[model samples]
Structure formats: C-alpha cells, structure tokens
Target: MNRFAWLDAFLGRLIAEDMAVREVPEASGLAPARGISVGADDWGNFGKSARNWNCRWAGCWAEDLGDQLRVHACFEKDHGYLLAHTDLRRATPILSSHAPYFPAAARAERHLQDLYGIAFGDHPDPRPWIRHQAWKNGEYPLRLDFPLAGNPLPATPADQGYPFQHIQGSGVCEIPVGPVHAGIIEPGHFRFHAVGETVLLLEERLGYVHKGIEKLAETRDAHGLARLAARVSGDTTVAHTWAACMAMEKAAGIAVPERALALRAIMAERERIANHLGDIGGICNDVSFSFGFYQFNRLRELWQRTSATAFGHRLLMDRIVPGGVTTDLSETAARAQIDQISTFRPQLGRLMDILNTSPTVENRLIGTGVLAPQAAAAYGALGYVGRASGVDLDVRRDSPYAPYHTLKIPVPIEQAGDVAARVRVRAAEISASFAMLEQLIGGLVPGPVCAPWTPAPPDACGFGLVEGWRGETLAFVRFGTAGRIARYFPRDPSMINWPLLEVLIADNIVPDFPVCNKSVNGSYSGNDL
Candidate 1:
C-alpha cells in the first residue's frame, strides 16, 4: 500500500490528521500485501477516503477473537488492491459504519451486526438483515462460543415485526413476494411499491437462507473446507471452490502444477458456459418466451452431462481441491467435450440471431429495466451486469491469475445497460468462454494433478479473486493456531449488485419486473450466505 503515492498517502494522511496507528501483518496479499490501522476513535476520520469516493471499496468483514474484534477492509489500489485490518480493543463493540461511503457495505455491516453483536454508529439501516428475530437478543452466533447446533425457536413466529418501508399515496399498492417462492429456488423476499402498473420502488429482503457458513467453516479441515466452499452456492460451485483453493494455496505459498492450472481454467469456463445458457433462457422465460427457455435448458443439460462425464459431477462440484484440481483429461473424453462445444457454438449463434431479430423479444428487452452506468459503478456491480452498463472490469483480463495470465480474454462491453444489453453480453461471453475452453483443452500438459501439501503456519492467510459466471467472486482465509480457519470471508458479487436492483426496477412496470430481475439474477443463496 505504501508503494503508490495516492493510496499510501491516503493512509499516511489518516495517521497524520486523525489518530495514532499501528501496523500488523496483512491477512491476504495480492502479492506484497501489508496492513496499517488507526485507533477506533479515528476510524471515522480515516473512512473519509471511502466517503469521498477516493477509491472503490471492495469488502468489509469482522473477526471476533474474544478480547477484540478484527475488521478487515479490502479495496482496489488502481489496477491492484490493498488489504487492511483494524483491531478494535474496547469494553463495548462499537464502530462507525462504512455504509455512508459504500452502499454495498450496508449489507455486510448488517450481517456483521447480527452475527457478531457489533454496534455501528449512524448505520443507515438498523433493522436486522440476517438474524430475523430467530435468536434471543444479546446472543451473537459467530462469537466462537455459539454452539454448532444452534438454538432454534420451537415455534418460529412470522417475522411480522420487520419495519418494511411503506407508502401512503392512493393507488400505490405493494406486492410482497417470496422468502418462500413457487419455484425450487432459494428463499428471498421482494417488496414492490407500485401505482396502478408502474413500479415506484423495489426493496429486497434477503438472508432467509443464511446457513451460518462462516460459523461452520471454522470447524472444517482444509479438504473439508474446499468441499464446503463448493456448496456455498450450488451453481457457483466451480468458482467458489477455485477461489477458496487459490486463497489457501497462496497462504501456504504453494505453486500449483501448470497442467492443474490449465485444467482449472477449463472447469471454470465450462461452469461459465452452463450458467449463461441457463440465465439467458431464464430471462426469456420471464418475458413469456418458453421456446428460448426450452432451447437453452436442453443445451445447458447437454453441457452439464458432458461435464459429469469429464469431471464426474454435472455441476463440477468438489472437483477443485485445495492445492490444485481433482481432474485429469483422457483423450477420448477431451475430444468429445471439445466436439460438443464446437457443435453447440454455431447453434447458439443462430438462436441468438433469431431472438435478436424477433420483435417480441426485442420489445421486451430493449430500453427496458435500464441501469445507468454511474449507478452500476457506485454499487460495485460485477460480471455481465457491470459490463452491460459500460463499466468494463473483468477479473480474468484486468487482474489475470493462473491460465488467464497466459491467455487473452476480450470482455464484452455494452453501453445500453438494459435487459437486451445483458442478453448481448451473455451471448458474447458464451462465445468467448467456448473459445477459451478450446484453447485450454487443446493445450493440455501432462503433470501431477495435485501439489504436495504443506500445512499453513499459524495465521496463514491469502486472498482469492475469481471471475465467476455471475461475476467477480472474492474469498479471504486466515488459519488459526492449530492450522484451522481463524477467519474466512467470501464476498459474492450478488452482495454488490443486489442493492442496485432497486435502482433499475424503479421505472419499469410491475409485470416486467421478472424480466428485469432475471437480467441481474442476483444469486439468492450466494447473497443470503
């Protein structure tokens, strides 16, 4: 952090103008990682950088180490980023909120509040975001003392005490949907404020499916943790697992085999292809185009079936292990997979052309559910959603890691930021992912699939940032005294994009909300956890 004048000076300025500080070892470094901190009294003054929008705020999380709470802030430093942690030692758990500067921090802060019993001053929203009145007051579940089998209410009452915002104008009826939806999807509630047919606002109520992953992750060994990461969000299995593996490997300073790196890239691209196929189809189905849904569902099923043949799981779950990946390609299986992609690409191009030309599809997508580029950037939008809105920041290209370092990936950028633009981005990404997969599969090198294991030194730490199908997925890890996970935080892109969902759906009608929501497709389980 001290390397760059602007970023380093920002912290220097904090120490000079605000509070006395100390420097500790950083949890994870994207290479040359360091940490500096200011006292709790000066925390608010130092936060002025985020408040002034000097740099983009990546993520904020807390670790309760009995005597004190360790809060880490991850933010980008131009092309690279800096990781910093602030140690708060006090009689009471209280600190200033980062939500004032980064709106995305609001959810993370609320999450910390419910999980760790931390209090924040001037928190924009005081309502419970994760707890949902399930546990008794004064009981923080993630404070190391909470039992593994949680104390659940015998008869869970309806969460009628939540203070959802209301409107008082005539004809402005509210539609409350989900937490328990019709489909087999995860739970999340959506409240839409509408007048007649036009939507005035959309407030999201998530965290219904919070599985206490942070708490459970503490008990898992290295191999067990990798398996847990794979299940973080079932659809993002490959991305999440790779991120966890990369972080752990980095912490141990272990180099994965070249062949393993190439194989990991292959698995990631396959996951991307499958998810885009499903999302494109889902967006169409929401707009009453079931034909598109059927076409894509079939393609996705074929893709996953091939994945099962190649990696032994339809969704590629648990295939990415800690040191490397659990995969070795046979010529027969590799060739068949390549041929499947070759055949699928041309069909995808033709179908996309037909849908783009169709008046019904175009009308439902174009100029609808528009998210302004400025708003997108403000909310730290990632993946296709950010690209569609003219904010092109692809992790694979911008911040290259592993196989991506040796390959060229053209990030699809669209300026319209509407449903149609999202569709275009997905279609383009599907083509790009296919081409990348072709390169990875065709250029396989023979080597050991897994690297020899080395136990992390006490407090071993690293950061993993992978561009998942949905977007940039980040995971941080720090090992404990006995080589166990002391602190682990995975900030999903859905957390960043969900807040902006309110912005895009404002002018769109109630009926079109489904299509608009599908365009963003903020992961329910990913965001909830």
Candidate 2:
C-alpha cells in the first residue's frame, strides 16, 4: 500500500477545498517534513483529515510562549512526517481537542492541561494527568513566569483526592496495586476490576516519578540540555542523548562526520541488544523460570561490563554530545565488540531453542496478553509491542536517518500479539541488531568523531526521530535568541505504549498480570516525565 500517497492527495484537497491552512517551512531534520499551521478552531478538523488519510498520530506537545500556548501534533505515514501546530491565547487557554479523532491524543492533551493550564474543550476525560497536586489548579508550571525550583511540596499527600474509574456489578471486586512494590521497579498504581479470576477492566494511574524534566529544559545551553536529555530515561540514555544532539545539530546546520554516525549506530545497536536480553530474562523470571532469568542476567551483566570498558559507562551515558559522540572508538574496543557478539550469539540461540521447546514456558507465554491489531493501531503502539501486533512501523526502515539510511535494516514483525509473540520479536530484533552492528563497525570511516560547534539561528526549529530499543523516539528543539534552547520535548515510546497495557490486560487472569506486564514493559520513569 502507498501509505504516504494520501498525504499528497490531502494537501491537494486542502488547496482545492480552500481550507484555513497554510504551508510553512519544515523544522530542520535529515528528512524535510510537511509543515502546516492551523487555526485553533480548525485543529480538530485537521486531525480528522489526517485520520481519514490513514495517518498515524506520532505525538503531541505544547510549548508555552509568553502570551500564548502553541500546540503541536505530529503524524507519520510511509516514512513521511507532517507537523501541524495551532496557537491558543494564554488568557483564554481553550482549544478543541484531537482526542475524538486520535485516541492517543487524550493523555497528551491532559498532559498539556496539567503543565500549561491549557483547557482542551470537548475532551472526553479532562482529569489532571501529570499534576498530582504538585501545584494548584490555576498555577501553570511550564509558563515563563513559573520558578524553575517550582512551588514548595504540600504537607498532605498529592494523590489523596484523585478519582479512579469504578465498576459496580455482582461478583466484581477491585484490586489496587502499588505506587510502590516489593520488587525493585518504578512507581505506578494499577486498579483491576475482576470477576472470579478474569480481569474485567484495568485502570492505571501514573506520574508518581514526574521530575519536571520539561520545565528544567528551558534556557539550557546545548551541552546542558544534552546531559538532561540523557537522564530522561536512564535505560534509554544513549537514544535520548543521540536524539537531542540530532535535533540541535540539524537546527545549527552542523553535519556530523561519517565515522561518528557509524559509531553512533554501533552503540545504539549494543543498547538494543543488551535491553532485549534483560527483558527476555525478566519475562521468563515472571513465569518462574529462574534458569532463563539467571542466565540472561549473566549475559546482560557481561554485556554491560564490555560496554563500560569500551565507552566509559555501563549504560553509555554522556557518550553522545551535541555535534556528535563524546569520544572515538579504538581498534581494541571494536575488536572486543565483535568478539562479544560472536561469543554470545551461540549461547542466545541455545537458550532460545530451549525456551521455544519447553512446554511450561510455551503454556505460560502463548495466547497470554493478546492485544488485537485494531486496538494496537488505535493506541499507536511501538517497538516490540506494536510489531507483535502486526504493525510494521520502525523508524529505522520507515523514516531512515543518518547511517541507518545507508544500511539495510530488517524489522521483524509477528501477527500474534501475545507474550510469546513479543518474546519472539525481541529475539529476532537482537539478531538483526547484531548484524547491523557488524556492518557499522566493519565499515568505520576515517574522519573526525565530532563536528564543529556553531550556534543555530534564533527561532530555528528542528526535529529528531530515532528508533530506540523501545520504539520510535522523538525529540523536538526550538532555539531562542543567541542559540539558547527555547523549548525541548522528548517523546519516549513508553508514553504511547504504557496506556495499551490497560487495554490488553482485560479477560486475562490476575496471576498472569506479571508476565503480561513484563511483555509490554512500559517504563514508568519514561512515561511520567
């Protein structure tokens, strides 16, 4: 199917129909996006048009200008991106919501309402999202006048009066899980309504770990923002840092060296492989398969140790700077990387084979936590979660950037949207990442690792899209006067994927929640921020 053909046809329709839309220069990036500015009144119509054209909603964010709030919506189809934005007056901060057209926009709109105090008119659920009594109802934290340190914490608990959905029926009881748990994990509250043992409905309450990441990004220099982006989600530090740098580099018109791009790909692939290994083991551990858990963790620990020796950090934090990577790869490190791949590849194959043939693991994983293809598409799920549900969307292949465009990247997909299917997808991706790493490392070009630093023009806008281990990761950067960061937004794939867990958990037994949750494994820290 020509997924993006409708984009051109839609533009033509806009021109012919004389809709209140105007084309504008795209935000700077490797690929030029179709940018359009829409009036606040026409925002919902714009989203409807895109939905009719079969466009997928990527993400939405709002930036607080001095007197107005600019809301941005991103859509993607067939490797193409269209950015549509609308501005609302600060005093009257109300605009039509896109939630009616795009279900994924609901949380994003609520997020804007919480931070920017922008009311989304006609929104289905207007409850506070990221604001768990951190601030008052009228005090917007993202505004320019708001203090960076923010208001003092209240003496009372923040989530005291929050409302959760209630189901009233015979034999239906609610089970409230934790904002804290016995095992080490991020904080989130999950409410499950079940009859007998089958889950009837599941509602999630997040934002316990909100650290004011977006508010802290304002006015930061290039290096400072880079450091902050790396911590947006520690597990995805390499990806987030790379994305922030890509946005800054594009805005400044600085081209990263070929060698640096290749090295970046190598590190990214390593990150993907390490995380997948850990996840595979975690899923098995949830099913009481301790052998798989211990073995996989053993491999992951060794993998991180090698990464530390090669890149000065186990998680590869601070490895990526504004222009390019922080340091160059040496001969010994490259050889060690290749050697590690060779050594672990066989062990992984053996373990996977044992898992595939084991009746116990197969019984626990297969047909568990099945997410329908329609539901997956509706939520715009990503990474292994979407791929397992047959949504063949990968930023590497769909919207290639830098070294990825030059390499042949294979995206593995599965039709079964179950725990087993997700595991299979991760194993396949690890294999694919191994192959890509070999290509990236073997074809190391001779050039500078980092590019020259130059200030971007004032008011310049740039977008960065990278397929992180979890899925399509996006970073948007706008520069103020003298190259100061006016606003920075990083959309982790978790933000979209976490909500789908609630939808997929229904009709399953409560005992299977652990494995099902692990199968989707949405990062609470990533989603909350």
Candidate 3:
C-alpha cells in the first residue's frame, strides 16, 4: 500500500470538485517532488492533510521575486517529499497561514514576514521572528534591490524589549537566560516561567546570530557557496555542504561518479559518528556523570583525529564539493579507518553496557522529557530526536540518495521518547555507521573524485535533501546568469527541531533542564539563520 495513499485519494477529490489545482508531486526538483501548487483558497486543505495524515512536517519556506511572493510548505511521507505552495501577486502579497496546521510552520512564516514582507492572514502569533526590530518597516532584506552592505545605520541596539509572556501567580517566577551564554556556545535567549523548580513555560528567542547568509549567498559561485553552507553550523559542516552541493549539481544536470558518491556517503557517516560522540558525552556531563563524559570525549577525539588524517579537516569542512567530494582517501588512512572500526566496536559496546545499567543515568533520563510521537511528527523532528520519539523516519532509508540506496542502512529507532532512548539510538547508529564505513572503504572503487558538469541555465532551480547528523537537511538553490547564485536557502534540521525543545521541556524541573536540552541538542547557529 502507498502509506500516503490517503493524500492522493483526498487531493483527487479536491481536483474533481474544482476547488484545488492539479497536483504535480513529481515536478519540484531534479528528482521530482511529490508535491502540489494550491491556490490561496485551497491552502487550508493542505493544512488539513498535515493535521490528519500523521505526516512528518519537514520544512516551510518563501521566495520573494519582487513581483510576487511564493510560499512553500514541505512534508515527508513514506520515501518521498510533499510540497504545497501558494503564490500572491497583489501589491501586498498575503495568504492564509498554515502554522495552525503544522506548528513548525510558525517560525518559518514569521521569518518570511520579517525578511520578505509577505503577510500571513490568521496567523496565530504574528510576532517578529528573525527581525529584532533592527530594520525599519518596508525594508524587506531578501528582496532583489536591497543593498548588499545592509542599511547604513549605527550598530543595532540591544533587542531587550521583546514581549515575553508573563505568567502571574502567587509563587510563579521567571528565569531569563542568555542571548549571550557563559560557555562556548552561540547566542540564543531562553525564558523559563516556573513555580519554584517546576517549569510551566519555556520560550526560545533565537536569531541573534543571523549573518544574512541567504543575502550573502546571492553573489557566490558554486564552490564559494559550498564553503558558506559548510559553515551554516560548524558541527554539521558536511551535512550542510553536501546538501548545498547536491542542489548545485542537480541544477546543472551533473551526475557524480559512483566512487565519488560512495566517498561522500562514508564522510557523511563519519560526521554523524563524530557529532553523536560529542553529544552523548555532553549529555553525560550535564548529569554530573564525569566518568561517562571522559570516556565519550576520548573516543570522539580519536574518531575526529582519524577523520582529519583521512579527510584533511577535523570536522570534514569543505570536503564535499558541488559535483562530488573534494579528495580521495590514502591507502594507509583507509586501512587505519577500517582497523579502527574493528577495534572500536567492543569498546563502544562495553561503555553502552555501563550506561544502560547505571541507575543514576537512568533516573535522570527515562520519562524526563517525553515527546509523544504525534508531537514529534507535528514538529517535523528529525535525526536522533525524531528516532527516539518513535517518529522513525530516516532520510537515508526513506529517501535514499546515491550509495545509501545500494547499502543496507539500518536506522536506529526507540519509542521511549526520552533522553535515555535518544542515547540508545545514537549508540546503535554508531555501530551501524562504523560497519557501513568499513564496507565502503574496503570495497573502494577507482574513479574521479568530482563529476564533469555544465553551467546551469539562468533561473534554473534545484533542491538537495541529505540526512545530516541532526536530521533531514535541505537546500534550495537557484542560479542566475553565468553561474552566480540567484537565491540560496539552506533549511538546517535545527529549524524544525528547536521549537520542539520548548514542548519537551514542559513539566520538567529547572535543574533537569540541562540534561533534557542536551538530549535534543538543537543548533543555535543553524536555527538562527
């Protein structure tokens, strides 16, 4: 059965009634998207489908073409993507908000309101999302004529006047944390409304680090753009770069060589392993599990060092090129990586055994931050967070790209929907990734590292979707004349997962917030953009 068979059947009825436009699910990207373009009147139907279908809400985005504003809301069903869009051409382009249907759509649409001036009708909360009242009204930054250097004004004053909702009660109190943090972390403000230690509401205020990445990308070539995307979030360098490169390659109609595809997959898996190692360690450290922290930290250091020795960068930065990967592994490095996997398996197993049986760790994790599967699906949660919550969708398996299509990728899934389950899922994924890397490296194919390609036609559009360590990542790339970027939008998985953090923290005490937050591990930089 087509798991999303309900969509086609329901949409067909709309088309028959002349209320909905014909769907072109197989017409969005180089590899056709299972999507449709609905009129403003029918946009509500898409929202209904999202609420009723139990679909994974992937992302929502907007494009400002000076003359018109187009909004695209994305969803994932089974192995394919579903895109729903509505266009507005009037003086003030506006449409019904879909955020009521998909909670995750709120931030995305609110962002467009700040950047493109596209208003949403009936949006539940119409607050400024990314724009912190810095730019004056009518100054839509993402529009074509906006100056590259930004508005000539004094440095933006501190945005401290944000209207955080007040919860007034006899014993209720509020705790406001950073847009500036004490540790080596990015800027994001968190507001916690609590009664004693119990948190009643959690508010996340991000976008303090917005670097105008989308605006800056308009002038870059493919190679230059890849460098920028790689830094979208330092921890997810490979994932963001690969997604951007895939869109560039697809737009230019270039096919990467089989060997290059395999190498890309291997490098991606390595990135996944590296991040999970650090996060698992961070989770332990938060709970004062010092022994577990050191053990995981040591393993992560060694793993990243091996990756640098082979890939030429510690975090594999800029390793993924537009058409393919940047370099090949040396024979010595290849053999070492394989051997390391062999030796590391048992070490990982022992550590996992200890963590699994440790009552202290279990007490803090189990049922602490429970994310029901329905909420995960609504939030469009991805990566470990989604898998732990029983929303078992892995882009590598569901939407296979290149080598993952050939290899057996066993996505680790757990339904506990808590910190411990997230930890277990990562442990399982590390083992699977280690073995998969060994197979890919041992069966190495001899071929060129990059693909031969042609320049893309002006205004050509393409999209890339890759499974990053955090979750399903996507990049939308459109080319101008002479291969310059017209528009580039990178949808880091953090955009969707970050809001879910607020939902997860509810009912948890203030002291346990650190462990719960670490479990989700949303990227502030990624979400800020």
Candidate 4:
C-alpha cells in the first residue's frame, strides 16, 4: 500500500475499534500522517508525532492472553506499539496482557506492571521487571498518590517463585552468575542451564537497579526533567539530554538556533566516539586481549578528558537545553581539538591492526552468539547490534535532524551478528564519527549558541529521537500550564536490546557469555528505568 493509504487504513482500524483519535497540527510532522494528542499530568497538552493518518487513544486495561499480554496494538511503519494497562480496581486483579505483538513493548510493559502495581495477564514471562525487593507489595510508587519519600518500613519481598523451564540430561549443570559481580557493573542475575559446556536454556533476572526515573520525571518541570533524562545512562548523557531538550522545545513551538543545533550534533558525535572506543577495547578485553584493551581504553580516556576540557563535563552533561546549547566552541579551541584528533588517528589505526591480526581474539568472537537477521528485526535492536545483524536503520540517516542533514552520515553494516561483527561495526562508527567531527569543526561558524524559548502551551506534546551511542534514544515530552512537565517517557535503546541477549545466547556455550554480552553491552541502569 502507498504511504498515505496505509496510514489511513491504520487510522480507520483504530477508530473502528472504539479508540479515540485526533489529528494535531502543531505536533504533526511530514504530510500523510497525523499527530495523536494525549493529556499530560503536569505538562498540559502533550501530543505525539504520528503519520497524518494515525490514531490516539486513552488509558487501557490489560487482559490475560496465555503467555503474553494482548492488550492494545497501534501500528507504526516497521513495528507496532502494544500497551497493557492493568485495572487496579478489579477483585481478581488480573493484569492486562499485551506485548506479544511487539517484542520491543515487552520491557516497557514489564516496567509498568512493576511500578503501577498492575499485572500483565498471561504475560509470556512475567518476572519482576523494575520492582526490586526494596518496597512492599502494597506500595505502588508510580501511582499519582504514591509518596516520593518512599515507605519507612521495609516491605516483604514479592513472591520470587518464577518457574523457569529446566533442561535435564547427562552432563547437564546449572550456572548462576551475577546480581553481584567481580566488576563495578550493575547487578543482574543470569541463570544458564547447560549440557556440558553448551547452554541449553538461559534465564535473565534483572531490576536490581530500578531508580524510579520515570516516576521522578512525572513531578518535575521541563528543566528538571532534562536533568533526570541526562542521568538515564551516564555514558549517553549528551544524547539523552539533547533528546529531552528537543522534545521540550518542539512541544513549546520553539525553534533552536542553527549554531546551537550544530554544537549539539558535535557533542553527540564526540560522545559516540568516546563510547565506541571504550567498547571496542572492552570487547577485546573480554576475549583476553589486554593490549587492545589498555590502548583503546587510554584513547577513550583521552577523548573523554578532551570533552571535559571543552564542555566542562567529561560526558557533556547539561550542555543541551531546550531551544539551544549551553556553550559554544571558539574557533581556536575547535582547531586545536581537530588537530589532536588527526594526530590520534594513526595510533588508533595501529591498535586496530593489532586486534584484527590476533588469531585468538578472532577465533573466540567470529561465530560466537550469532543473532540472525530476522531475530534482530523482531527484537527491534538498534545501533551496532542491529547494524551487525544487517538491519541498516540509523535515525541520523533515515530520519535526519539538525547538523546531520548537512553532514551526510554513512552507516556501517555487517551481515554477521557475532561478537566480531559488533566490534567491527563499532570500529567503523568511530572512524566515521571522527571524520564528521573534523568536518563540523572546520565548518564551525560564529553565531549565537542558544535561543530564548518560552514555556510550552498547556497540553502540548512533543517527541524527540536521537541516534545515541547505544542506539536510537527516544524522548516524549508533554508540557502543562506554568511550564511544569506533564509527562515524560525516555525510551533507551537498551530497553529493546537487552531482551535480544536472551535469544542470541541460545545454543552458544556458557563460556562465551561475557563476549556475547560485551557485544550487546546493554546498560542495566538504563534498562531498569
């Protein structure tokens, strides 16, 4: 079907199904699609960007559907958003089930269930998503009435009796890892049931670091909300902050200065490079290559320190504000930095050669934890993971924004979805980002770095999507009267990528978990939010 025709048909389906639908002009994007409007609790009229022919609906209650929730389905271009809202008033109190239609929605639904005291009826696998053992069963912190101070007394732990399907055979053994680890990483439990060394089944139990970020955002103003967004993942601070600011400005009908937009892009690319370098080294370290690890790590540290010197923060936190950026790069500073990057290129090339030629490194990573193209698409994986699996979707290229439009982004892709493929993708991306940075610095123009923006009108909604280091980082913002935040939803790519880990780990030996994990490298804090 044609684009507009397909959208109309989709809208028709929603309206026919008794769902509320509205076409919002301000929040609308390119033609042939519609913007759906929804009420923001603190921020007034928040609208979502949709095809000119999209549908908008209100609160929904979940219903059980065996192993998954079959609550509500809203279609997008490549994937759909299925939501399950549990009715807390019911006596039997069955959670509304959904997310079977879209694997990406599974993590979000699980989070809703955990925070809102809602249940996903017949969810395929209903483990405690965001609920840590810190609170009691009767305590639902996300509810509008839930106190922010938290309960004084410790609540009994929720029933921990999840029935994991077990595999039994000769030479079979169970391997449990984490919830506590040797490193400083966040806590997550992974249970691998294996026959000899080969993994038969893998079960993941996360939520050890649920920070209630969403709940916190629900109470703050736009500025306060942006601060919280930046903390979603420390490494991706610049990307997340930019997304939140973009969403707020869009909702407020504010246009950012061209120079500010350029600066934002530069910061984002720098952040991306810093992370890619670290991860490339980290993946090598996982396979016991300390030389590559130390060298790449040193490079990453140098890059981060450069960013700190330029932006006043190593991760560039708070550099993005609604309608603009917080600082500008002087011509002299830009030139010096660009020259430094040029000098660092040869050293990076040498490290790359060392890693590429190592037989031991290549052997462990080449065919380990293969995620086929189809599985990658189904999981809605993004960034390096998706690229490695042949899903060539980059927000910067496909959905161009800001300086990215002026500077063409060449996304690197690979057919192999193994650890080695992930490493190669990161390496390629780092090179591309450095090239783009040089161009941006060369083209830097002296102008105002920020524009003044008034608060958004009551009941305005806006959505922002940025290509972060991990993947596509999405932020939905709604503004209420008096400039308060109405509702904020920041969806990290980790939320979608983490589940793919389970699928990819299958049939692979238990010993390769670290290598496979480093390839994906999902943030536990980001996902727990």
Per-model TM-score on C-alpha atoms? 0.96, 0.97, 0.96, 0.86
Model 2 misplaced stretches (Cα beyond 4 Å): 1-5, 15-18, 26-30, 154-156
Q: In model 4, which runs have C-alpha deviations exceeding 4 angstroms?
A: 1-5, 12-75, 78-96, 152-163
How should the candidates be ordered by lDDT, best one leading? 2, 3, 1, 4
The Cα RMSD of model 4 versus the native structure comes to 6.0
lDDT of each candidate versus the true structure: 0.83, 0.88, 0.84, 0.72
Q: What's the true lDDT of residue 282 in model 1?
A: 92
Q: What tens-digit string does per-residue lDDT give for candidate 1 at 1-529?
A: 2334566566676667746666665545445345666677766666666457356677878887778987877776554666666777635888888788778788888988888888888899977888876676678888878886778888877677678899879889999999888665678899989998898988999988888788888856678889888988999999999998888888888899999999889999999999999999998898888989999999999999999998899999999898888878788889998899889989999989988998999999999999999888887778899999988788898678989988879899999999999999999999999889989888888889899867677767778889999888889888776667777788788888888889999978988988888889888778777
Each model's RMSD to truth, in Å?
A: 1.9, 1.5, 1.8, 6.0
Question: Tens digit of lDDT per residue, candidate 2, span 282-318?
Answer: 9999999999999999999999998998888999999
Question: Which segments of candidate 3 are over 4 A away from where they belong?
Answer: 1-7, 24-28
State, as a TM-score between 0 and 1, how close model 3 is to the true structure: 0.96
Whose TM-score is higher: candidate 2's or candidate 3's? 2
Q: Residue 34 of model 4: what lDDT?
A: 35
Cα-lDDT of candidate 4:
0.72
- For model 3, how does the per-residue alpha-carbon lDDT over 151-240 read when each residue is reduced to its tens digit? 746877777687888899899999999988766768889999999899999999998988888988997998999999998999999989
Give the lDDT of residue 159 in candidate 2. Answer: 79
Q: What lDDT is obtained when candidate 3 is compared to the true structure?
A: 0.84
The count of backbone overlaps in candidate 2 is 0
